[model samples]
Target chain A: MSQADLSIPFRRRAGRAMEDAFLQEALTIATTKFIGLRREAFDAFPEGEGLRDRAREIKEATLQHLDRYLEQLIGNVERFGGRVHFATTAAEARAVILEIGRRAGARMAVKSKSMATEEIHLNEALEEAGIVPVETDLGEYIIQLAHERPSHIIAPAIHKTKGQIADLFGKELKRTVPADPEALTQLARGELREKFLQADLGITGANFAVADTGTVVLVTNEGNGRMVTSLPRVHVAVMGVEKVVPSMSDLMVFLAILAKSATGQKLSVYTTLVQGPRRAGELEGPEEFHLVLLDNGRVDQLAGPLREALYCLRCGACLNVCPVYRQIGGHAYGHTYPGPIGILLTAMLNGPASVKELAHASSLCGACADACPVRIDIPRMLIELRRQVDEKRIAPWIERVVFESFGWLLARPLLYGLAGRIARVLQRPFVRDGAIRSLPLFGDWTRTRDLPAVASRTFRERWNELERETPR
Target chain B: MTTRAEFMARIRAELGKTRGLPPATPARRPARPRVEAEAIRAELAERWPEALERFRHELEKVGGVFYRVATLAEVVPVVAGIARERAARRLVSWHAAELGGDLGPALTAQGLEPVAMPPGEVASAAERQRLRELVAAAELGLTGVDLAIAETGTLVLSSGAGRPRSTSLLPPYHIALFDRTALVESLAQAGVFLELWHADGAPGPRGAVISFITGPSRTADIELTLTRGVHGPKEVHAIFVEAPIRG
Candidate 1:
């Protein structure tokens, strides 16, 4: 589901995803493989633990003085003959890029995988303005052809099967290809190569921008980042303000652990460091370079509850390990980002009310925190978000009433015991197998899960009886 | 549109509201990057054989072909043999100034058509376009490595006056030549060299990009089935010359 399609409600979307057999198998295989790969990658590298801490420290440090680092980044980018633009909102970001494309007379823009651009829905705007935006990454290309959002961060089309992608390729290219991955990949390579050569504008998202050197770093496995930054006459990099690092030293710390967390590779196949526009004596590279610094709610989070989330590297490790994400998949989240971190990011970008339902999506398992390279304490922030949602009265009235009544009852000993006794008698008809499988007024809660029947005896009651029976 | 002043002001406001954040500092940068880089070089001088062995093993693990040769002259035969095996003849290479030594004549003598990129920027756009097309059509790309990271088996190549970014990128097969001089034990040590390159008043590569290539371009996007050469070279062969090519 698209961001605009959230009207369907997250619960129904999740239910639909759970019922899809193909998606179920796909999510299991894909997330399980990624979890194993990430584990193995870290297992082989003993020092990864220290580096993850260092990486976390660097992210926090940069955020503490984000203003200073951003200024340095802007100065150096301009010093290197690149232009810097400030965008405070997604629409503003889209406008800034659209104006750049307009001025450059760009007919086609080739883009690498970028959640920032995706968040802004840049492709639709570009197409509306008559500039063709081509997604160069194979997964992104497949999704773009299908008019779908990325279901996974690193593997955009993880929800897709080879047969489905072969069909996508066949539809887009007007030729049928086998369902083999290698054949499909070769066909996409041939298709995107032409776009790389012929496109007038190259757009990308910076994995990290070095403040001292004014370099925008892009790490990709398929080399599309390099192609996007190198091929076209005009290049624009849209990046969140949090992506800037203090120096090259800090960047290497992230580089050491980022790929390990995402994939098992020690480093991605290509780590392209783009300083600025092409220099005078260079034969290739864009002549004009532009870096768009995107705020779009990230600035508010410095003092907001989701501040630690700013340290997110956009690695999908959290998604792979998330129980909700593994079961329901990304589309159920109904936003640009999906999964545990995606919930916080969605809240960060859209606000607390946006994730009224998504906030309760997690089981608070803490696997995401362990898998997170930066250790952002996702569950802590998630609970915080849930509180904010409740405070704002954004939760459904039924949920608010139930939780508030429960809180009220728990605050008074006599009332709590009385309510428990009443609940035990009322829960008899719905009780089966020692659990409440359905309820007259709480079907929403029992639809996908079971509520433990008020135990045969309350814990407080049990404790009191045992004390009375014992000799004192 | 948010102006720079407004953007910075808002950031400063949010930063002002932040309370009791953990005390954390970024990674310590080298005080004198050039000095630290030289120290790393001297340290690696004795440890380079071990570093080289680790590099070879890691590179081969990533599906990259690793070869060790005595000098730059031997690089041509290896390139020719790779070409013969694939039935490829057309090759593109960096200029001799950037590559450390000329291999075009030797490669040509071995029945390969070698195109050396312009030593500096071409003044005419048409000529630049022609060069891009030439590199795109070439079957092989040959360039010299600026740094060979042993820990990750990565080849670091910076674009500059004589080094075009497309030489290693546009071709199907990439063969990079490096020596003991370019070997760095780990990414941390490579960081020192990178710091030196960007240090105040330091002379760095003139071009706009530096690429760290670990293996050929790969993806597991479709069915999570790993595929190589999705957009970049399919095969990467690194030739390690015992004698430093610059000398």
Candidate 2:
């Protein structure tokens, strides 16, 4: 996201998305379709539930022994003649990759759809250094051409219409193009095919790095992942530390569930596992392979509060099921990642202060948890983040005061009853249609949603009346 | 730059703080993968007809074309027919040794330009570049499947001496030849084969990549409109030969 977009408060950004007629319809259709697809996928696969649990366990197990696994991964990668680079921060990651580009004399780099690379903001740095970074995935290519960040995790261009895409392509290629997906895709394929063959550097993100065999796995519906890794002279894979798995067996468990959760496929069209650079007899593959192990903020979360968030598969399922995301879409979240999980990730990456407003973005419906293939318990962590935000004084004074006073009143029955009566007396001016349309200093809440007027008769009053009327 | 030592130390520090958490272990791998794999192969040898039926159903479900032939020689006509339908004249294929036989001459006889990749690395970079251009320009790519997953109708191809990755990738149409030998019932069984392949150590003289291709490349990114042939083959064809090509 750009600094200008980030400057807008979350509420205004969300309001803008809500008011856009096209985006509203697109979100409804896309999320509704994704929800149905995911449901059908899991409903047919009876073992999906058990596999979810096992996948979660595998993630936990891997994290528990992360040091050892990473060590083994590093050793084996070297054994396979692949270099391993460590990046403590995003800057270091970009610097390492830029140095590699400089050494390789790379004029251009072809990149597959990799959130890791996006998270690190690698493209801007590469461009500044005079190396062209080409996003090869169809969705990513469209967004890259428009100079926009991805709005969705897997479907980066879901927010865009065919007409908009036609315009973008026409502008870039300087030719009139039709508003048809097939024609647009073919045009992109033709444009990127030459870049694939000509690029000197190929960059990707590992979906899972097998520790035992020293392999980096990439899952994509498009074949950009294959093209990037195979054709370029140098291939660089940027991956978070949490992406490593123990063995090939563990990888299968994930493969079965990942696509089912993301796009409801049994498996994506391509699951490419590249171990290292081209072998001696291999006709085509990168000659030099580099794996960059990134820690930016993931290392702190190993023992931190956001630990379970590490198990996220980047499937975008939570986004589909999230009420907030469905209404406002990914852009409102104002971060690299956007969804229920994106809030926690934003908190993890930027700090608790950054997500003070974002933490309250969820309605605590827990749909994200239920839809999660690994069941990350997103709501539970969200509540924790909210508490941390308040405790750290990141929340506004009014919110803290209101919540604290409510907690105090609820703990004392007499005070709660007294307060309810006082509130009913004070709410007469704003209470219409048995709901509060607006309230002094709380109009923000009532602006979009109605607050139920303190009941005409409190539940306690109704209980007392029932007791009195019952026969002895 | 973050040195390996400092990075490991930071990870250790955080890991040290995590204690008394719930116990968990990774998925259990097959204890003796080689033995287990052989047992699976033997079991599949008997039930291959059912597996093949399921594979065909699933493959077609994902927009793949399937063919059944009585013998390896019968696959030639099917390939020619596919080429004729698509008007694809140029083809690149794995080496004769890797493909189990040389179909190049027969394919050429059918009025198609067919080239086979060298079995080993080319001695010169210029020659390698030339072969890459050949694969890139060719409309049809032919290779052999290392494993054909019945559960998802996926064809697993491991890159190696004769099998250049682009033979199935760069071309617009990918046709893979396999028999009961490569058929596996599920991804779990495929896992066993993978474990067995890498059990002792690295396999001898192989490429550095293995691709599990479920179908042709597709995307629904633009307005959620599904489109095929984004960057990989637009059409994938799998030919099942009843008689083993190796025999």
Candidate 3:
């Protein structure tokens, strides 16, 4: 779908996704496998639980004094001859990176998989400026060819079958290859290797930045992080302000648990720690280094209702466990981020008005909170967002009216009892097999689910009868 | 465009709005990193055999081949045998100083064409480009491990003079040689060594990058089917030298 597809109502978009049989089957298999792997990985390591709590505390501590750590980060990066730029918005971030590319005389840029770049839509901006942005990560490369957004955080192309991927590659390379993962991967390696060696600029997102050592850490299984940071003449890393940690000691605590939560590995294949541009005596590295600290709606949440969201590691563990996401997948969320945490993040990056429909997407089952490595209370914040939506009058008039009248009745016992008695009579015609299968005014809700019929006898009536019969 | 002052000021204002948050602190850094690192070294001196055993188990679990050689001299025969089995030639290795011994002549005597990287940076862009081509075309990459983490079967290599990052990347086969000195029991112990490197006035890594490689490069992106060597080495071989090469 193009950007115009976003104009469709979120409900309709989600409904369409539900109709896609391939997507449904793929989502079930992928998420189920990820959940099992994460469980097995954590089960083997007894220290994982304590490490998770420690990681959570470290995130909070760093955020509480974000200013000091950021300043230290800036100082250390500069001390090592790297330039730092501050971008308050996505547009500014794009402009800053474009300027860097222009200054470096870059013709083609190679990139590793980065949600920050996806959030800013950097590839389009780079293209407009006449710099070809090549995504080197295999999964991201497939999506870029298919002209689609990532459907999963760690595995971007899971929505695609090997046949579909082989077809996509055939379209790109103008030649047919066998529909096999190994063949497709080798072909991509060969194709992207030439780009890596020839690209003038390399772009990436930092998994975490060490404030004390001025190091930007990138975790990947494909080794593209190393290739991008090493082979190009100029390197640029864009990161959210929340990615900064205090020291290398703090960084190790996160590394211990990051891959386990994301891919169920003890550690990712490659954890590259880059301090700055090429240092003296280095044969191959970028001549210029730029670190862009992006604040695009993140700074507001430092004290806003979504403050805890800044603690997210972007592991996608919550997405796997979320019942809604498992059914609809990522693109149905109709934004850069998707899933339960994606709702809060979308609200953080956009606004509460942006997630008016998305706020109600969750079942509030608390499975997401349990699966979260940092133990973020996602359901609690989701309820807060729902309340915000209702208070702002963003919900439809019918919903507001129903909920408002329900609240009024709940506050008054006499009216509540009388209304229940009236509902029992009114519900008799619709009630069948003890369930109201359809309702005239609530067709949207009743179409997919059945509402329980009102009881034949009111609870208050039964309670009074019991009280009268009791000897006491 | 946002100035640093404006950006930081906005953050400061938001931070001020928070009140009565729970008390929290970051992980406690070692007070004296160098001393702590030495202490770890002293403790490992007696427990290295156990650490090495764990390293072998974890390494094999991740599909890596493990070999133990009594001395650095024996590394050549193992390398030759691996190359012979795979019918691979044209190997690239770190400079003799970085590898702790010169094996170029011995490897050449075994009928393999080995190229050692220059000890320092090549001044010209064209020369650097030529060197990169050689590394990229070589079938095997040979280098020394700075830290071999046993708990996770990870090899940590720092890029510097004679130790280019691509020595272990951009090749089909990667063979890393390490000694007892480079072994660490866990990531926490490696943390102490990392802290010691970046501590005040300490001589940290000579280059700007440190890579922790657990196994061969892999991806399960296509239908969740595991495939190795997408953009890095397909096979990783770690040879442990029972005698310290640095000595």
Candidate 4:
């Protein structure tokens, strides 16, 4: 789905999510459970706080010298007999992978869970080129079969129920299946196993690439990351330039906190580090290895407002703790990425104009920052994005005019007092009890919430009366 | 397409526009990683018993089975028992050179068909294909562990001659053998070994890949319901040997 097709607007998408009874229950249960699990995991690990700081520092240090690290990484990859490609945009990334697929004579490609691939719409491009792209991750596979996109970063199919998943499997596999996760998983295992062995190309996203050693790391629970990199004849790892870390020691700091933040596990089931193509003495591995380093607006963020977001691990912890995200699920954001970090990422990729409505999705709650393993000051960046939206004139005219004029009036005390008096008279007609239930020109804001009525007598007026009555 | 030169130039341009954000540096790596790693090994040589107990405890917490035996010969009975209980017939394993001993004959006597991978690369593509199919069909996969982390119950395996990555990945059940030499207390210590492995060119050719296996392959994607063995082993069994296999 293209951004243009989301013509329904953010309000309608969020409203539809709010009205979904199943989604409401699912979000509450899933996010609540994740919050508990993460708290418990951290409570047990004594060094978690220090590790988070170190991880954040590693990200900052790497970005500071990214040029040097990436060059070293490229040289080492070439030394290990692997090829590297540079992509400045999503379209260029897709083109590079498609060209690799064509040259390898690949008819089928199997993919593990990859948000980068999703961002670039690589599956659609592969299909258009007559090569079948199969999603091997269970969550990704379910969404792919259902012709949908991921609704969560880690738990992609949290919006679906067991019965809904069974139906999806039944329709795709052409058989009746039970509504049991165990049974459904076994069935998928059998089906995807065939694709794993038969597919000529395997694609994955790097969790972290060790710059000094030229290793592409993939952290997964289902081991599809291993299968994709091992079984296919050609392996392609798509990664943002920011995924690179300085050294092996720095990689370990992230390993300590990544899975704990994501799923409360001490570590994920698999963290596979692939250096290059198959070695001379190895029995089974991809003969050809390609690393596609994608810029995709991430480079621009070095000095841009969203520079801090480059430290995101995509752990999905912030989403579970976010009040707005908890109310409205990922799809309501209408982008490849979702949740607090997703809003920043969307602006980084599609520009600030794309996130005009999304910028205000947060209540400036600091819960996301506390929940983040890397401690990204998400609320700070979100406020900056909102300012950018209004400054760029991407926000609605009414919102801009109201906030801008409010700022203008606040700078002058006389005008502010006069405006307060004017609001008191104007609000009398719409005030019900203590709050304004509705208003003219901006009724949309008060439709779902009540705005407090301006006090009958302004504070200045009360103070002036006090001065006349008291000599002190 | 963006050239490497062009991409770096763009990054440098953006970086030049920034000023004093904060003073930060990456985690400090050991100056002589090889020496540091050796020191860790020397310390572990005395504390392996405690580390092994922690490893077993953590492994069991993640739904894995852990066993400690007196010798390499004792591992066969455990493997046979696991196979017997599961009614498994075919087993794929690393070659004797990588595993430290050949258990093919003993495993066959236990009524299991065993196929150990070639010590070096297969001569023919057809042979490689046949081995892959065999691994995919096998019910059990056995290999050796390079490092067993006590804090997280992770088994680190490097892919190289004789030891294919699939021996720990392909089948429904995976069994790994480790000893005191491979035991580590934390992921930080594992990092030291990792740095040492890639340090000064003094050793043989390193493998192209290293995997850290924490538990069986799992997923909770379907409505947050956890299920195991989605694409990798459903069960992971770690057998700790009291007597070193190499010795």
Candidate 5:
């Protein structure tokens, strides 16, 4: 419940979010608006199918040949008067950026929105090192001020209402702040603008990293990408290895989908492509540029059926349209990345050893894959991960025992019949109005939906009577 | 990390490990010789004129102006009138025949000084402070759109000659010009425009992105309340040069 123990499974922590009515309403409103906007943004367009297809092809091909592209990208970025760092894990990434922060003498950092930072807990790292990491995006800035982590990907503060934000800011600043979206935005803007002016380093994330041109593309509705990339003396972009594309041409395919997929705009209000820090003649760019490319578990995913999962553009379109995600919301997923995409991402990044239960959270309905812009087979990946966990003996003994009993019943007809008869007898205690009202060992399910009662006559007994009634 | 070759070899080994990718079913290919771009352009042009008008109306709703001009000859005289009307001093426009040496001489002769904007100066705070110096000292900013969208009635600009991203962002007043063909049905069509710009057929990766300006630089950033031209151009002028595309 405290910051000291934040690594608990989503199931345990999600209850707190589920209990907050304001968070529920805020999430519902924000997601509904986003889903509608995305639908209206790309619905029945000629370019929709072509854009998605091209994006998918580009991602799959990049994952297949990722190392070659990454090397070329790194070389070209270095050639363009920029530095490239390869970090294989979150710790490595944080350490690399922290070192950059130290080298740049960054007392303060102004950043655009980055999910990777949330995954790595970069703010905590910066704060520990006596560096202030200021989030420039309005939503992120509000949440940072409140000392909370992002509940959603694109819009991190999607779960909090204006009233909650006002209350938090009021308490923190020792002054009353109005609970209006307009007023709250203005107050945060006034507060963060000073940080941007004083920042020594600007941190950002890449929407697409073009290898051929050694360009990092950032698409944002707010001008934060530009401010973060250009204003500060040193600019550091932390990107996952999967964010790379082969060429500028390949970058075009993603640029087509990311805007409409994320916010349903023709393009983000601002899309800045940083070729290599500051060129000699360029007047308004960082003096030095550092790109930290993190691998972590992406290389492992690239060689398998799960490679398609790497094709994600972080459009959040999949999350927007998912039925289960819509019902349970992003906070319920409990991982830094939540929803169907989160399920695969958390398992992959957390490794199978740490998360044996997160894999089972999926409904296996294939909705996530259906809604995926790059078409990651999420349900398939979930199933594969479950298999890997079983094979590696990472699954809990109770799960193994339950499934063993399932196999036991299937292999023995007499035992299966006897079990059915006993279940019917046992149903009497719990049955209320022909539905099982209360059952042990199954509260999470029965609490929400009614459990159907077992039929009175066994199929075998009915079959035997029918055989007797017939001319046998 | 690992050697790039070892990384690639792992892929080859994986390919060998699995059955070869499922055989792709053969399908008939479209029997088209080439894209008839001229025909498409002409059809687009016809629909785009009305689309431009509709777009102009939309931009107007968001506090923008739509001007219809016939000739480059009229453009200089009109800009001079705007300067005289606003008591302007300095003006910034894109590097085109529409606002070039030919027109520069005419504007000077008409008692108006023309200034070309430096590229990519918008991102610099120091440059911004300097531009604020220039913008406060000056009266008007003029630039050409990189492209325009018909569906949204938006203008797309990038970092290029005459159209400095900073000039558009720093100046209080901006005037942008485009042809009717700049109009697309919607943002989806605009994506195709961008993809085509990066396509092998078109020039590749023109710096940054296609910045679509539906109206003036407006933001709901200040307390989620609508404020115009806080960081960019306060007022915008969208001119539809309703004439045939000169080759």
Candidate 6:
């Protein structure tokens, strides 16, 4: 949780990833394939952009009246014969889940990919209670076996190579496994299948909680989540309070945008909605269904400009497309959520003061916001967080002085222009191939890209020259 | 209880309501219009022929076999074939009249029993429990795609009558028949289709879960290895049912 511990070192991770030629090849190949496939999915339609706009609008409307829908959701859940509990913190959320596990006398939990639970560290808490929790997402399950945290928001183990995966299987699953992605998936299925059958509890995250019918919509490519909810006698869904939308009409927007942005598909392979426990008329749902709605700093976000953070669908396309996330992978972020979204989420949830170090993780290049389907101005938010960090005086003295100097100079055009000319002249020593090379102050920025040289003639100088020649 | 708005007002008052952030200011517009939908689609189609080809290619990539049949009548024999191959006896199915008349009679003739039940009439835990047992025991779970996205070779079905939401899930093997005409290449088109059908109510899909299933249920739970059918339907049969050739 400390700042030093939290620096994502995305550039460093990316540098290492680049060095591992095999991994670089895998990542490039996979990312390229998926991005193209995603584009194709959108291309098949004439109204893709409009669909996204509609979806985003739906999402906004849904979240605007979220509280009302949450109430309706509670009412519907109760009416449908489900139990809903509200939690104010990670401890409370964990307590509710563990209590459910205890009451079920559950020894193991099979979990779907739910960032809310990860934010609460549900697995560690459950393990402390002497119950093992298994992650069933292909990416999550792989990382779980390695005892590592998720790397990307969606593609958790995107940084891992096929060989690393094959080795993990060979050693842990005790069989020769191929480097094939298919073989890897089959291995996970074989292993989780038994757990699904034996586990006493199913813990999942809700993608969207529809208030109209009290349905918990869970979308997954793998079937593990469905089993986690249905097979287990006790099903516990841990979701953020913001996850609930008011109606099915509102739910459509998220459903449309979520998978498209996340996996670049029309939809994932599986989307299941559970209304409540095995209704009197239903056959296969959990006997007891419990929903734990965690506030855990989201309420604070709702009150400020940072509320856009809540609108994040966790699609992870932002991270996939983010230059920063591509480099560090997910683990170096040192939080449950990773990438641009993870930085903001961890900062808000862990108490922004504690995560001031993460405030500078991104370049204000605007790609994260650009890739964001919900249109969250991520860079602007990061800038705001940076400002807060400085105001709180938690930012290091050196950084404070740098931005302060820049700010003061920018306030006076004359001073700024003079400084700019001076800096261009001073850059001779660092210039390599017309770009800065190995500058002492900020080497990371120059490490990959050539910092383009400032034009020889400043705009002011040219403007003055033109004025002198004009008749006026 | 106080009036609904009054109740909310009281909570806000008790909580010490204060003015919050100003509404989001609109950004300055770029001179050129952002590309329109048709243009984007045409660009996508032109620039991404290989990708478009791959989209359909990948559908067959992940253990999903999609058929491109012309008519709904062709649906019956395909359903019957799947049932016969699975050697299914008690079939738990959704309410698709097309399937019942076209496929059900064929299934019955083939000695494959098809029981199409109304969704959610199981009034007690015992009945519900029995239904769950049937899902696990049944040979094949049959249902119709509310809409299918060709770009990903996905089947979209929400729970309703005959589709005992549980029947589509929880089964070992599931065979879904979709129309090729139903296939839209992009999520944008998929969105429009959903919008068009938005108000056409089917129990409001209360607990209405829109499932966009691309292939059979799969997992990689053990050691970062892949396996199919961990929780939901293990084997999925997607019959694309392509539109019939014009004479």
Q: Looking at every candidate separately, what fraction of the true A–B Cα contacts under 8 Å does it contain?
A: 0.89, 0.91, 0.84, 0.90, 0.09, 0.29
Candidate 6's DockQ = 0.19
lDDT of 5 by residue, A1-472 (tens): 2121347665565566566676566667766777777777778356777667667766766665566777778877887678888776789888889999999898999998888777888999998988899987776777787776666677776766667779977986789989876566556655765566579999998887877667788776656676677668899888988898876445655665676777666555566777666554344457788888876676666656566677777878777666656655676666678777877777668786545766776678876676666777888888888888888988878778888898989899999999989999988999989899778887876876699888889789899899999994
Please give the lDDT score at residue A459 for candidate 2: 95
DockQ each candidate and list the results. Answer: 0.85, 0.86, 0.83, 0.79, 0.20, 0.19
Clashing pairs in 5: A182-B223, A185-B223, A186-B223, B94-B162, B148-B182, B150-B183, B150-B184
For all predicted structures, in order, the TM-scores are 0.98, 0.98, 0.98, 0.97, 0.81, 0.78
- Compose the digit string of candidate 2's lDDT tens values, residues A31-99: 999999999999999999999999999999999999999998898898889999999999999999999
Segments of candidate 6 deviating more than 4 angstroms: A1-23, A412-436, A439-459, A470-472, B1-173, B177-214, B218-235, B238-247
Better of 1 and 6 by lDDT: 1
Candidate 4 iRMSD, 1 decimal = 1.4
| Candidate 3 structure quality by residue, lDDT tens digits, B1-247 | 8998998999999999999888899999999998998898898899999999999998888779999999999999999999999999899999999999999999999989999999997899789889999999999999999999999999999999998989999889999999999999999999988998899833357799999999999999999999999998999999999999974
lDDT of 4 by residue, B115-185 (tens): 99999968799999899899988999999999999999999999998999998998999999988999999
Candidate 5, chain A: TM-score against the reference: 0.91
Which residue runs does candidate 1 get wrong by more than 4 Å? Answer: A1-4, A469-472, B201-203
TM-score for the first chain in candidate 2 comes to 0.98
Tens-digit lDDT track for model 5 on B45-116? Answer: 668766776677767765778778886567776777767877875775554543333456677788877665
In model 1 chain B, the worst 10-residue window by lDDT is B201-210
